[model samples]
Target chain A: MQDALHAALLPQGLHDLLPPDAGHEAVIVERALASITAHGYERVKPPLVEYEAGLLAGVGAADRDRIFRLLDPVTQRTMAVRADLTPQIARIAAVRLAHAPRPLRLAYTGEVLRVVGDQLRPERQFRQVGCELIGSLEPTADAEIIALAAETALGIGITGLTVDLALPTLVPALLEAHGITGAARAELETALDRRDASVLAARGDEVGRMLADLVNLAGPVDSALKQFASLALPASAEPDRARLFAVVAQLRGRVPAVPLTIDPVERRGFEFQTGLSFTLFARGVRGELGRGGRYRVAASNEPAVGVTLFSDSLLRALPPPARTLRVFVPVGGDAAKLREQGWITVAALGPVDDARAEAKRLGCTHVWIDAAVSEIA
Target chain B: MTPPPNLARGDLIVLAVPKGRILDELRPLLRAVGIEPEAAFDDDESRQLRFKTNLPSLEIIRVRSFDVATFVAFGAAQLGVAGNDVLMEFDYGDLYAPLDLGIGACRLSVAEPSDLSQSDDPSRWSHVRVATKYPNITRKHFAARGVTAECVKLNGAIELAPSLGLCQRIVDLVSSGRTLKDNNMVEVERIADVTSRLIVNRTALKTRPEEIGGWVERFREATARNA
Candidate 1:
């Protein structure tokens, strides 16, 4: 086998996160982590690889084959590259954070690999910057996570962003209230996910019809909330509905400034979401910049919620942040002085003409002369 | 249904098609439904992620089977074809799997080593630890029996679980059961018989009902003809 050839062709679902794109992605992640940190979300770095068993512990079957698994030569145990950071975070929270305080807030930024086909618009290797608020079932936690996500997006210059929200709890409650069995619930969710109202109407009972209708409701926050309120749901179903509404209300009261909408039928990405879920979309972007929701412990039944921004997607929708000081340090110039001024200086050793072109290419607003020791504005 | 205002008029209707085995099986089905993808679609060596179909209005994107649900659920692709396995795994609330294409036929089942099957009675078990690709379905299947199933999820090679002592039983899709037989496993319980279904984004279906519904009808007719 040609190792070089294989290396050159780099397998599907893996790619080199090259130069400026890589650098810019790093900067974006730093900013995201800073913002999340300022909100008292601490950071955690999980290993990029874990035992296959540990990695797959609570992950669903559909995602099993998507992981890049290989036998660890040292231990002879099967290991997998991280496909999602959430599970690892959960594992950490279960073990390490068990002794920690309630409502643990932790932030993470890292690469995740999924065995996606080469044809998907999303890259197989993409950066995710997110924060998980664990051990809290409070609706305020849900609202706060979403609010932070909105703020982080704005902080990164992602404007005109629309956050489409949903609740996993409500769907199940509605199914139970309508006497829909587990199997029927699965089928109805499948139907709702596909947006086939005809099928939903055909297969769904009265509750399915109402749930399906709610799943399709999307628009301004107030109207969406009113539509949900008018569902006239029984007392048993009220808590889930109230939690969903509370998250919305909290967002309105706390971060009322952010452009938020209530999408009743906005049944996007419920597979992993256990409670409140949302996807942030900006005008002109083809896909979501970030998406996440509460993830309940399948084993211990603990409550957890977090949001991960596809940094690559966010980068595409947002203009690179304005460069602070574009210092063009000429060849053999005092690199130390530019450092003192805290300028992002680019060192160029080419001819004077090439130096000018380099300055233009680097988008430097000012060039410093090496020999003359003068700054060129 | 009028096209959603968010979508540009000339924007092609991206169809999220699952890659690998299903793509191979779906090629004929796609053609049956009047979609002829570019030659590059057939070339496994191709690096292209998105491809154009013969229809100007339709483009095909090959994604993971799991992502087919996510893509369509989020309305990233207005349409998709995914197995019930993928459908059960994510169970996105907004997607509508209107028509059963009946391709990629298989069953989601609980299997154990043939040796273990002799002593194991699923009905008698109070609690069981199982490794599976489908935790939701597995949990639900066992929960119905009043058995607390501690499921250790694995992405693939579920057949290897029993031998490795990861778990005594595995829940996965059984097609020919060749993979199970090779691993000395036998089906102990059957979950749902699986098949690929034509899935559409609910919003896409509602807002562009006529167009999406027409496609659904076309696929329904195609499946009927095949049947």
Candidate 2:
């Protein structure tokens, strides 16, 4: 009994996906991949594990701690399980497919394993479905990626979506312009990251007051943009604000039905991002459904942006998929014909006394009788 | 069929509050923010854990002071009122202490027996043992100054530890210092000045900015009125 109990236990933040959930996850991945592929994005499959040096090169530098590493016995070299797939796509774009094309579009779906988990999202092993557009510096690229993300989610039955746009570089650019460096810069950054307006208000400096005002500008797009347009920004940080406004305008032009909001100072989880970023959320979902932004490809330094959807969070946002109608076929029945008719046919291994009773026992909705499908209930 | 009022707008927003002396100071603040809980909430003898407010989209849950941070950090409750002492002790990255409520004034201090304090020098100490409900804060406070603190965790009656030889000192919240005087102890050090804060879940703030940010603004005005 003790051994059985121990066998049932898995390591923290890891679990098995069983039954209807596994099937539903597969459906969602396939639907999302097809939708992305329809927009001329080709699918690519990266391995689950790779050499630590090759895996953690370039963009993977910041993610070293989160990756699960082990030593390869044959080669005696270190290997690592990928904690994220976007870095791999970047590596491919820079190395393997370096000469493929300009503004290369690649889509991917695979499982990622992490070393640790936080209280909010405890799943260490989960699937990621995302697409990256590499080698583009256009604001339209940002707008396209965001619109595609929202459309892909809507195509998969997610509703009430809101995309919150962020400019991670805006505040840092402001601080650089002000020459506020050393400990003061670090303190102000922390205060901004925590959204602590009180601490910023206490500073009472011009920069401090500006940052406090930015903290309060995290709401709807029109009103926040109205307030943002009136701010007296330095010449250096003005481009970031202008670029954010342009992207917002483009996104509205592209997907006017989807809700858009602005958070000018949201920099967390976008440390690697270089420019405009956005996070997708449903009305009542607990966490972000998907997020992406502009980042420079590590090795090539080509500007890029991508969106990755957490399958676990996406599953929660979507309503449970409708159950497929399964029809039970007894021995000598035309199971193939039943399947061709768009019914999931469960074939009988041996003869049964009653086809309807057998269908009910096997959890089928219908049974094959006299060369025709009959409803079981 | 018509939907419930809370669901009609969105998910019901749960606000967690501490269940002790802080509740007395919080009553008027809650009213100023336009939240009035059911009459049974004031009885003190009710076993109820959750109570509805006058607002259709809001509700309140009474929990232990320390647990208030845990609830909001987990996003089980989208908003809460907790002392900074609990915030520092947990240091949950998911919480954003955006506003200081200016209530529940106190200080987290280290105290010991009067005789020990008379001849004791904190600078000369190499290692010290202390009892506290906030082991994280106590250890961190000592470690910042190149000292090692062996903390024995206790939930309540931390003042009894020093007198019973459990430890030479205890770290606990001191409001008036009367509890220490009654135990024949004297204050040795103050870690931080404590006050209740308006804590919002990081995710809630991002997902529902209008609703949650509106609440923060409302509370800001309420605190200002009280000041």
Candidate 3:
């Protein structure tokens, strides 16, 4: 009965990380952390549960619903499992890491919960490995994050991937400069989001018409950016547009041969992005491998940028890495000789062929033939 | 698993259903069109994200209302149902909203504390700070009138913003005005009347014209009959 209860009570949206899968995930996560840390990003671990208000204070409503909520019996206050790591990282940057330094680079790897609909075929309980480079308004920060994301994907064996880029500030700035009202702007932007040119045109404003026209513009980055170059941006916004172009130029310079496209009206995950936003997609996968963008400091009017790789998706798209093994064996046996000769060995109590097969299946390149194996063989 | 067979280029059809409110509203429409989802779909308490419909060739995935456009735009889901509000939010270029289901009736509007309505004149304001779920929409709405609106973007509970002093005004969806009245707010402006739309992935429609277009026409007919 106790065993049955334990089996039945396994937490929903949470599961035990089995040996081989767990080891594979751990290796990928460590590699991602090492890559980010090498680029001057410090690693930090945020709490698995945070005060409900702290998590929801500035997060969007849709995201608020996704968090796993509970009441802390001791305090009788609501608490929520961390559904996303970015916000907690933001809070840390705002409160704890405020005095760290200018352009603080931070990286983290953890599990995030989303009570996703069961109809979605992906795992709801999964790991997120990512980095956030805060306090930098430079395009270099954006380029570094994007490059890191691409490199991490390649490291995990995900090929034929492309990064779709969009600027959330571009269209909004244009609407503001054209004297569009807030409500009308929302309406027009919604139209643009839907790509409803007729709805945008119906607004009867030259700016809305121009934005509607721009929403249809899509192509390789160079052509799209060149087309956008012709727009008459205001003096204050010229720098932002220039910065966007500069970011594209830098990405081209650093990762010259990667496929990058500019989707000016792309609105997939712009809900949280304040500047350059991107989503990574592979050839066969239905969803994005990862997504991240620049988020503004909610408290102070400062620029911040970061990216997070959905490690679960990454693993799904790539083969598991090889595991290292050192097997112990009885002395003065075939396995002992194998171990002495630099092969991984364990005291073999079974057939040598079975042991070698098991080792190979577990991604161990070397296998030791123990005394028990010699006795059997 | 195995990426669900790569969606078969043109042989398969995936339908994207917006979870929650619209899912409930769409049940009857789906039944009318002969595409009932599995029983688990009706169990709102279920955690499943994808479900099989009555037809072997068709499947449904329940995602956030805003993601319907994304799913369809990326060809992840060949078809979807989304509110005009959502359609307005992400505006995916590859999606084409051809049919209006006429359900999920609501209006996107600007709301402020009821007391402020007595003295507030929208036309007289030179600048405003607004809390909204739709920043692009909110900023564009204000900018049209030459009013510089500082938008504080909130994902949900835009109504609570006014009471919490997060902002004096909020732009959100108003269905019955009960939420606003309960929060001591009044409608000050309207953004757009919203309804759920039948959106088809353009690439899907182009590739499987008959099969995909046939589903569209069937839904359109069902909508017409219901009307």
Winning candidate number (lDDT): 2
Instruction: Residues B91-191, candidate 2: write the lDDT tens digits.
Output: 77778888989999999998999999888988987789999999999999899888999999999999999888999999999999999999999988899
Per-residue lDDT of model 3, residues B1-227, tens digit only: 22346455335577998887777789899999999888998888999988877786788899988888888877888889998887666655557776778899999999999999999978888999999878878888889889988999887878888888888999999999999999999998898899999997754553344577588779878998988
Q: What is the lDDT of residue A197 in candidate 3?
A: 56
The segments of candidate 3 whose C-alpha lies over 4 angstroms from its true place after superposition are A1-19, A57-62, A74-76, A117-122, A175-190, A202-204, A233-237, A298-301, A320-367, A370-377, B1-227
Q: B96-122 in candidate 1: lDDT tens per residue?
A: 776778789999988899998888666
Interface RMSD of each: 6.6, 2.1, 7.4
Instruction: Please state the error at residue A12 of candidate 2 in Å.
Output: 0.8
Candidate 1 local lDDT, A242-308, one digit each (tens): 7888888788887777766665544544555666788786744656788788777544557988888
Which residues of candidate 1, in runs, are more than 4 Å off?
A: A1-8, A59-62, A117-120, A177-187, A203-205, A234-236, A264-268, A298-300, A320-332, A346-366, A370-377, B1-227
How would you class the docking of model 2?
A: medium
Give me the displacement of residue A254 in model 3, in angstroms.
Answer: 1.0
* Residue pairs with backbone atoms closer than 3 Å in model 2 (clashes): none
State how far residue A99 of model 1 sits from its true place (Å). Answer: 1.5
- Which structure is stronger by DockQ: 1 or 2? 2
DockQ of structure 2: 0.56
Q: Give the DockQ (2 decimals) of all models.
A: 0.12, 0.56, 0.05
